[model samples]
Target: YRAFERKYRKNLKALYLVHPTNFIRLALQVFKPFVSAKFGRKVMYISDLSELNQHIRLDQLCIPNAVDEYDAQLLAKEKKPSAAASNAFQLNSTENGKALLETQQFGVSLAFIKENNGGEVIPPIMKTCLEYIS
Candidate 1:
């Protein structure tokens, strides 16, 4: 990190960290005092892709598929309900509950997939398999 920083510090504009975990947060907090204030200011802890997209165009980056998958997982986790709410949902017998369940494929919403794919409904079989395995 030091060598890279030394070489590119002058040219670098910002260093964005997407989906920073708790360990990363703790490390940054511990090492922050050692780094220059200017360098510290340049470090941006991005919570999600949407936040990173605001600073730079995602098309320009050669992001890995795993990174995208991880970001999606993080987003899904954030949107997931509490244990009590999930139990309530499981017990629900209303048509609305069924409709809501249908809308969710894997962790991603069917509406989201349709919107991204020009109104086409894509089968989310992978999620069903994953759920079964878990």
Candidate 2:
């Protein structure tokens, strides 16, 4: 996967890890050090169909039944709640005063998020990207 991912890195727009398992997530973390910082950000974990829809247009997508069934099982486990937290984005405040982001394929997709007044930059070009978030 690492080699395959690197080979197609240039043309790759986005990579959605549909129905990810804990083992898969851990494997990614173990190999994260070998990958580029920017490359690591390319991975995004989508647990179910609805979450996938937010990032992609469903009409253009094709999901297998096995994937859907796996998602349903995970969803069921989530509804009942478990001691372990599900895959999610988290902000960590460290002693050094650095805010670290913890996520699976969790990186800021866009250089700029929202402005002070909840508005995105027009044209959506590289130059319009904000340099700092804080």
TM-score of each: 0.57, 0.51
Q: Which stretches of candidate 1 lie over 4 Å from their true place?
A: 5-7, 83-134
Judged by lDDT against the true structure, how good is candidate 1? Answer: 0.77
Span of ten consecutive residues with least summed lDDT in model 1: 92-101
Best by lDDT: 1
Which residue pairs in model 1 clash with each other? none
lDDT on C-alpha atoms for all candidate structures? 0.77, 0.65
Collision count for each candidate, in order:
0, 1
- Estimate, for each residue in 95-129, the C-alpha lDDT of model 2 and write its tens digit: 13545444312233222233322464542443345
lDDT of 1 by residue, 80-124 (tens): 889988877665533333444554544446555566665445444
